[model samples]
Target: MEKIVISESNYQIRKARIVRTKKLTPLETLFEIVLDGDRSLDHEPGQFIMVSLFGIGEAPISVASSPTMRDSFEICVRAVGRVTKALHALDAGDEIGIRGPYGKGFPIRIFEGNDLLIVAGGLGIAPLRSLIQYVLDNRRDFGKAHLLLGCKTPQDILFADELDQWRRRMDVQSEYIVDRAEQDWTGPVGLITTLIPGVHLEPERTFGVVVGPPVMYKFVIKELLAKNIPEHQIILSFERHMKCGMGKCGRCQIQNIYTCQDGPVFRYSAVKHMSEAF
Candidate 1:
């Protein structure tokens, strides 16, 4: 195994090699990367890293793989902008710049021993994938694990194989919904909020972690609250325009909080009043 001493410099950009790549969709590509000298990212479940393409610039990409997989980490990138488009053009063995496993991640420590109800919508599944993998890796640590996922169409589903495994796994109760379905898609169809009504959970003992687009949050939170989950128990991972992994830049600021530092993940109670947070 390759070994590397983790760097402490916030500005230091480590060289990372793309060990594997899979084209999940025309627009999205999954890249499995490992740092030079094999240094582990050593990040928490929901933390994100700033991926740089040299002259192209840097973008904050979530660590899609779990920390349990110590050999490497993964990021699912969608080709929406310049840097990400360049990232999509890279092949295996290509190198990219990386800095930080920045910001606070999901509070897995607090979720321990509590039943977990995780919700992911569209690309939101990318970050939640880290948490799901960690929970499954240490399956015995929690009570019950339930996953609720929704996407625009069947082709938009992120991890088909892993989703199937989770659905079939006796340990996790998983259900997926899609707004529109292809003829071959046989899964549940509707908004993700639809799945919440049928879930069997003890509200007081459950910690609900949600990650999705802005429009999805209010509806999902409403359903989670209807189930009686506490305000603090409802966690959310927000996807905002984060520039500069450090808090210096105001791009990711919502009121007084910096999404890049204070959070990308927050307890709903903390952001409920922040109009910018949505």
Candidate 2:
């Protein structure tokens, strides 16, 4: 249980070991990481960390696990680029560099007494999974919770086993849809928006949280707004190229706001008009 001590600099990296790994899909992998010294990554549900792999450079990855799970954190990665490509080559017991649980996360405190509608599309479920787990783990603190998930195909859905568990839970309600269905799949087939209308929720008491691709947000937000949910009650997490988790890089700027500093998660009312936000 060696403690991982970081230097005074905000950019200083902490050593983390991959305790376990699971190949979630052909391109995506889930890594359960334990920071040195068995430290807890006390991060809000939607915050992200900068992951470094020696000379390959670093990239921002969200904390996929809930903060309620104190021992270790999880991050889901897609092998799409240089840093992530290098990341995918590693396995359990591999040590890597980590910094931050940076950015403002989901407004769980504000949502404590409200019903929640979680909408996730494609790989967007990565970060939303944390919020979903947090709400479920603290079910008594919140009202009804509904998760509406959409992905490209049956094989592309993220957390199949865990989703099954969520579906069976009496405390949570979940519906999954895929763009293209497979022979073995029996669930609904359509856009994620289709499922939103059928959800029984009191707009005044419900908060809608959405995360997904740029295109997905357009339609999903439209549906959420149409459902009579207020603008400020709808939360959105934008997936940006957050090169530096510290917000100095300016790469993740949405107009005057730095997504790494001010957001990654923001109320839809605050960013809806910002062209670059969605």
Candidate 3:
């Protein structure tokens, strides 16, 4: 076992295809990546993998594809930093290093047979997309599932083709809002929180999962708590500047919790009180 571990430290990267790529917005790009080898990514929903650009840098990216798809995985990348900028430059059939399917994912077992209220804002939907696709794939494991997605503008939407498919599905009740709308936009317009009140849910049976920017959490969480969802049942995924995907790096530490190891995913009650966790 130790010999296997030592040999893999060189971080062998498989040559994968871009397979598909979409220019969601001027600043964001979504890449559908697949491994060239026979092995699948084998990731849980909400779990993130570190995408390495070799000489440039490594960035922690959530697996945006569902575990259902045997052929490939997806990652929605926002060109906000150096590593991401490098990632955005590449396209189909590109070679990039990959290290982990690290951090804990959503608690799929606990959510079994329970209603789910999934809330995603801005780039936050990048991570939640994995879990949503999973739940939709295995719809039997969960009860009524609702997705609430919000972005800066109509053009900012990620996974547009998938979003339309979700909107058309009878099994999944999905809605989206843009903070600001253009003349052509016809969907709901407002902060994501505005759409929360309209979503009727049994607070006791429903698990509220929210993933969004730092500012979005403070307000959205307050809405979920007010809806009577238990603090522990309200789940969230946090973001930070990460270096090493392992906990050894202090870059992603939030108080005593390491975002890379202890989470990127956390229950609200466990971390709501922590400063800078927003």
The candidate maximizing TM-score is: 1
Provide the lDDT at 45 for model 2: 95
Q: How good is model 3 by TM-score?
A: 0.93
- The segments of candidate 3 whose C-alpha lies over 4 angstroms from its true place after superposition are 1-17
Tens-digit lDDT string for candidate 3 (73-142):
8898989888999889998878887777778888889999999999999888888888888898888989
Q: Whose TM-score is higher: candidate 1's or candidate 2's?
A: 1
Off by over 4 Å in 2: 1-9
Rank candidates, TM-score, best first.
1, 2, 3
Candidate 2 worst ten-residue window by lDDT: 1-10
**Which candidate ranks first by lDDT, i.e. highest?**
1
Task: Evaluate all candidate structures by whole-model CA lDDT and list the values in order.
Answer: 0.91, 0.89, 0.85
Model 1: how far residue 199 lies from native, Å: 0.5
lDDT of 1 by residue, 68-108 (tens): 99989999999999999999999999999999988889988
Candidate 1: give the clashing pairs.
none
Better of 2 and 3 by TM-score: 2
Ranking according to lDDT, highest score first: 1, 2, 3
